[model samples]
Target chain A: MLCYRAWVETRWRFLICLTVMLLPSVLYFHELGIFPMQHWTSDPHYAYGLLFGTHLPSIGIWTFAAVFLGLGGLLRERAVGTSTLTLTLPVSRAHVVGTRVGVGASETVALALAPWIVNSSISLFERTPFSRAQAGWCVLLLVGGGLVYFACAVLVSSVVEGEYTAAALMFALVYGIGYLADHVSGFSALNLYPLMSGTRYLDRNTNLFPGPMPWLGILASSSASALMLLAAVTITRRRDF
Target chain B: MIAAPAIQTSSLSKYYGRTSAVQNLDLVVEANRITGFLGRNGAGKSTTIKMLLGLIRPTGGDGTILGRQITNPELNRQARAHIAYVAEDKPLYRYLTVAQTVRFAAAFYRDWRCDVAGKLLREYELPLNRRVKALSKGMRTKLALLLALARKPELLILDEPTEGLDPVMIEHLMQTIVARAAEGTAVFFSSHQIAEVERVADQVCILDRGCLVLDRSLDSLRESFRRVDMVFPVDVVEREFQLPGVERIRANRRQMSVLTSANAEGVIERARAFNAVSLEVAPVGLRDVFLAMVNGLESAIGKEN
Candidate 1:
C-alpha cells in the first residue's frame, strides 16, 4: 500500500524520464548513419558510435531524473505540510524511507534498462544484429555505477528541507564532484562519469570493453551509494521533523 | 487487570536550543475519556502532540501511548496502529480525490470504519471525485478529519480541531468527538473553543508557556472555581486579599474582584471581614478561569481577547 502511494507520487517523474531516454534511443538507432548526432564523416565508425551510443546522452538526463526522484520524503513533506499525515501512519519511519527508496531505485533501474531493452529488441530484427552481451554489460555498468547519484540525492533531500534547495544543492554537489574528478588529474580510476558511461573500459578499435566489464568500478560506486543511503536513514530516523 | 492510560508522559519536554516548547510536562490522560487540551498560541500544544506521535523526537524526558514507548521507533509505530490523529492544519494529498484519499487512509489501518466513512461523506457533503487541492478549505478540513474519525482507534488526538470550522460544522464535530469517546476512544484534543471543550471534555488541561498550568475534571472546575465581587467603604489595596486559593485580584475604587480556583468560601469569609457593603459571588466559567489563569501571568495575554 505504501508502495502504491510512493508509486503514485513518483510515476509521472519516472515516466517522463523513461520517455526522455527512450525516444532518443530509437532516434539514434534507426538514423541513416551512426554519429549523426553531430557531423557525419565519409568513413563512418559504426561500431565505435554504437559503443558510446544512445546511452551517452541518457547518462546525464537519468542522473538528474534520479536526483529528482529522490528529492521527496518526510523532510519535503514537512515543507508541504503533509509530514504529520505521513509520519503518523502505523508504519516505521524506516519503512516509509525504505519504500520510497525502493520505488525510486526500481524506477531508476527501469529507466536505465528501458532504452537498452528497446534498442536490443530492435537489434534482434536488424540485418546485422548487435551483441546482446554488450547491451547487458552496458546496463550492468549503468545501474551499478550510477546509483550513487540517486542515493546522494536521497541523502541531500533527507538532510535539506525544500525541493528547490535540495535540487540546487544536489546539482552543485554533483557538478563539483564532476569538476574535481576531471581537473584533479589522478582520480580517473574512481571517476563516476567514466564508470557510468563505461568509457574507461571501452576500446576504440573494435568496441568498448575489449577485456572484461569494470566490476571494481561498479563495486566502488555501489558502495558509495550504500553508505550515502545509510547516512540518510540515520539522519531521518533521528530528525526532529 | 487495569488498562493503561491512553496517553501518559513523564517530564516530557521539547527544547529548541535556548527556547523551550514543552517544559517538564507530566501529563496523564485517562482511558475512555475526552480530555480537552487548551493552550494559548505557542503554548507547545502542537509540539507536545508531535512528540507523542513520534513525528519529532523529544529533546528531554520520555512518554508513551497505549503503554508503548514513544522514543522507541518500533513501539511508537505499534502504538500508532491504534491511534488516530488530525493535525491542526488538516493536511491531505492535493493530487488524490476524496475517494482516493479515503482509500489511501483505509490501506493503513485494519480497524477503518467504512460505515463512518460513508456517513461522513454524506454528512460533510464531500464529493468523492473532487481532488483535495480542488476542494474548499472547509471541505478539505472535513476530509482530513474524516480520515481519523473513520478509524476505531484506542486513542484519538486532534490539535485545534475547530479552528477554521463554521458554527454548524463545529457543532457536528463536537458531537462526533463525544460519540467517539462514548464508543471507548480516549480522545485528547486541543482547541481554543472554550465553549466546545466545556460541552464535550471530561478533563480539561490548559498549557501556558510550555507548562501544564491547569489540569482538572470539568465537574471539579465547575464546582470549585469562583469569582467574588465585593464593595468596601474603605480604600483597599490588592494585597488585602492574598488568600491561599486566591489566584487573581482586580480592584477599582471601592469594587474588588477576586478569582479563586478553590476555597471560595474562605474568600467570602475574608471579604466579609473587610466590611463590604455588598458582595456578589458567581461560579467562574471556563473562559473566566482561562483568563484568570493566563492573566495572572501576563496582562498582555488578556488584552488579546
Candidate 2:
C-alpha cells in the first residue's frame, strides 16, 4: 500500500510527462511528413544530429521529467499539510522514503525507455534505418548519466519547503551547473549533458554513438545518484517532519 | 500485567534557537481513560503531540509512548503499530478518494478493524469515490476520525477531533470515544472546547505558554475547586488573604474575590475574621478553571513583572 500510495500521488505527473514527451515524437515529425520525404536519405547524418536519430533530444526531456517526478516526498507533504498523516504511519521513515523514490526512479527509467522505443518503432514504420543497439546505448547513457538530476531534485525537495520554491531552486541549480560546464574549465567534469545525450560521441556523418561506451562516466554518475538519494533518505529520517 | 502509561514525558522541551515551543513539560497519560489536553492556540499542544508521535524530535528531554522510548526511532516505530493518531487538520491525501485513504491507512496497522471501518463509512455517509480535496471540511474530519477509530489501537491520539463537526456528529463521536475507552483504548486528545472536554474527559490537563499549569482528575477538580466572593471593610491588606489553597485573589478597593483549588473553608474562616459584610462560596466549573489557569496565569505573570 505504500507503493500504491506513492503511485497514486505521482501517477498524474508520470502520465502527463509521458504524454508531453511523446507529443513531438508522435505529432511533430509525422505532421511535417519529413520521414516520407528525401531529407534524410540524401544526408549521411540525420536532421539536427539528434542522438540515435530517434531520441527526440531524449536526455534533456527525460531529465526534466525526472525532476518533476522527484518534486514530492515528506517535506513537500509537510508544506501541503499531509506529513502528519504520513509520519503517523506504523512504518519506518526510511521505508516510506524508499518506496517513494523507488516508484519515481522506476517512472524515470520508463520515461527514458518508452519514448525512445516508440520513436524507434515509428522509424521502422517510416522505413528509416534506426539501430536498436543505438537506442539501447542511448538508454544506458541517459539512465546512467541522467539519474543524478532526479536524485538531485529529490534531495532538494526533501530538505526544501514549498513545491514551487523547491522546483525553482532545482531548475536553477541544474541549469547553473549546465552553464558552468559550458564555460568553466574547473566545471568541465560536471558536464553530464554531453555524456547523457552522447553529443561528444555522436558521429557527424551518422548521428550515432558508434564506439565503446563511457563505462567510467556511467559508474561515476550512477554513484553520485546513489549518494544523493542516500543523502535524501538521511535528511528525511533525521529532520523533523 | 499492568500496562504502562499511554504517554510519558519528562522535561520534554523543544527550542528553536532562542524561542521555546515546548518547555520542560512532564506529562503522563495512563491507559483506559480519556485525557483531554487543553491549551489555547500556540500553547505547544500540537508540538507536544508531534514529538510524542516521533514526527518531531525533542530537544531537551526524553519521553516514551507505550513504554517505548520516543527518542529511539526503531522503538517509536514499533510503538506506533498500536497507536492511531488523527491530526488537527485531518490531513488526508487530496489525490486519493475517501475509500483509498481509508484503505491505505488500514494497510499499515495489524489492529485495523475492517468491520469498524465499514460501519463508520456507513455512519458518516462518506462518499467512497469522492476525492478528499473535494469533500467538505466536516466530511474530511469525519473521514479522518473513521481512519483513526477503525485502527482499534491500544492508544488513540486525536487533536481537535471535534472541529468542523455538526452537533449530532460530535455527540455520536463523543459516545464512540467513551465506548473506545470502555473497550480499553486510551484516548489523549487536545481541544479548545472545554465543554466537550468536560463532558467526555475523565481527566483534564491545561497548558499555557508551553507550561503545564494544571493536571487533575475531573472528580477531584469538582470537589476541590471553588470561587469565594466576599465584601470586607475598606483598607484590608491583600496579603492578609494569603493562604495555601488560594490560587488567585482579585481585589477591587473593598470587595475581594478569591479562587481556591483547596482550603476554600480556610479562606472563608479568614474572611469571617476580617469582618466580611457578605460572602458566598460557589463550585467552580471547568471553564472557569481553564480560563483562570490560562488567562489568570498571564495576569499573574504580568503582576509579578
Candidate 3:
C-alpha cells in the first residue's frame, strides 16, 4: 500500500516527462519521412535506423531513471518525516529498505515501459518498419539501465542528508559518465550514465553494430547497480533513525 | 518483586564526541504503570528514549525492554513486537493522506486495531483525506498518538508527545494515555510539562544534566517531599544557618524556604532557634519535588566546592 501510494503520487510527473521526451523523436521521424521510405537504400530509412540504433544502449537512460526514482523513494520519506514511522514499526531495517527498493524498481520499469508502449503504438499508425526484436532489446536495455540507476540513486539517498544534494549527485554521475563515453572510447563502459546516454543508445541503435555484445558494459552497469543497492540496504540497517 | 521490569537500564550512556548526552544512567520502569520521564531540554530525555527503543546504540552500558537485552537483535525485534512509539516530532509521510498513513502503519503490526484507529480519527475530528503535510501540529500529534495507541502494545514509549498541542488536545492525550495504562500497558514518556505529569503519571523519573535526580511514585514523591515556608525575625548568614533534614535552603532577610527530604519536624524545630516568626508545611507535588531535588543537588555541589 505504501509503495502503491508512492507510485500514484509520482506516476503523473513521470508520464508527463515521458511524453515530452518522445516529442523530438516523433518530429524527427515525421520531417524526414522515415516511415514512407522503408527500403534500406533510402536516406530516411538509414538515418532513422541509425538514430534509433545510436540510442539503443538503454544503460544510461535506465541509470538516470533509477537514480531519479530512487531519490523519490528514500528522500521523500526523509523529507516528510515518514522515515520515523517506518523505523518504529516492528519490522527489521532490511524489510523497510527492501520494500522501498522493490517499489522503486517497479516504478522505473513502468516508466521505462510506458515510453516503449507509446512509441510502438504510434509506429503502428505511422507504418514505421521498426524491428520488433530491436524494440524488445530496447526494453531490456531500459530495464537493465533502470536497475543500475535505481541502485545508484538509492545509495546516494542513503548517504546524503538532503534531497537536492542526492538528486544533483545522481544527475552529475549519470550525465558525467555519458559525457565521458561520448568523448573517450574505452570509457563507453561507464556510459551507463542513467539519462542522456541510455536513451541516446535507443535513439541510434548502436548495439546492432557492436562487437562482443558489450558484455563489459552490461557487467559494469549491473554490478554497479547491485553493489549500490546492497550498500544502501546495509547503511540504512545500521543507521540510527 | 522478582519479575523483570517492563523497561530496565543499567549504566546506559550516550556520548557525542567529547560531550556526554546521557551518562551511566540506571532506570527501571515497572509494568502496569505510567512513568513520567521528566527533564529539561538537553537533559538527555530524548537520547535515553532513543537508546531504549534501539533507535540509537548506547556508547556504554545496556538496556532491556520487556525483558530483552538491548544488544540482542532477535530479542530486541521480538520485544519491539510488544511495543509502540510516538516520536517527539510527530513526523509522518506528507504526501500521504491520514487514512493512507494509518493503512501503511497497519501493514507492519500484526495486532493493529483498525477499529480503534478509526474511532480515534473520528473522535479526534481528523480528516481522513487530508494529507499529513496539510494537517495542523495538534492534528499530527493526535494522529501519532492514535497510531501508537491503536497498536495496543504491552509498552508505549512517547517522546514529548504533547509538546505543541493545545490545552484541549493535551487533556485528551492525557486521558487516552491514562486509559491505556488502565489496561495494563506500560507507559514510558518524557515531557517537561510538570502539570501534565502530576495529572496522570503513576511514577515520575526526574532527570537533570544526564543524571537521574528523582525516581519515585507520584504519590510517594508528594508524600515524602515537603515545602516549609518560614519567616525569620533577623537575617541569617550563609554558614550560620543549618537545619536538620534540610536538603536545600533559600533564604532572604525576613523569609526563608527550606526543602526537607526528611525530618520536616526536626527542620522546623531548628528553624525556631533562628527566631522564626511564621512557619508553614505544604504538600509537595512533582514540580516542587523536582525543583527541590535539582536545587539541592546544585547546592550540595556548591558547598563541596
Top candidate, metric DockQ = 2
lDDT of 2 by residue, B75-175 (tens): 99999999989899999899999989988888888899999899999999999999999999999999999988987789999999999999999999999
Ranking by lDDT: 2, 1, 3
The parts of candidate 3 lying over 4 Å away from their true place are A5-9, A24-63, A72-80, A123-130, A142-147, A175-189, A193-211, B1-3, B230-247, B251-256, B269-279, B294-305
Clashing pairs in 2: none
Q: Which ranges of candidate 1 are over 4 A from the true structure?
A: A32-52, A185-190, B252-254, B297-305
Q: Give per-residue CA lDDT, model 2, range A18-95, as digits (tens).
A: 887776576635643645457666652564354354464656778899999988899888888999898888889999
Q: Where's the lowest-lDDT run of ten residues in candidate 2 chain A?
A: A47-56
Interface RMSD for each of the candidates = 0.8, 0.7, 2.3
> DockQ for each candidate?
0.83, 0.85, 0.47
> Model 2: residues >4 Å from true position, as ranges?
A23-51, A123-130, A202-210, B297-305
Per-residue lDDT of candidate 3, residues B1-305 (tens digit): 56569999999998889899898899999998999999878989988887877777888999889999876656787888889999888877777788888888888788799899888888889999999889988888888888888888999999898887888888888988999899989999888788988899999998888889778898877776777777877887644445555667776667767777668887778778877899888776677677666656334223322
**CAPRI-style class, candidate 1:** high
Candidate 1 reaches a DockQ of 0.83
Looking at candidate 2, what is the lDDT of residue B77? 93
**What lDDT would each prediction earn against the true structure?**
0.85, 0.87, 0.73
lDDT of 3 by residue, A100-137 (tens): 77877876777656655655665565655455556555
Q: Per-residue CA lDDT of candidate 1, range B1-305, in tens?
A: 77789889999999999999999999999999999999889999999999999988898999988999999999999999999999999989888889999999999999999998999899999999988889988898899899999989999999888877889999899988899899999999999988889989999998999999889999999998888888899888888788888888888778788888888888889889988898988887788788777656234224432
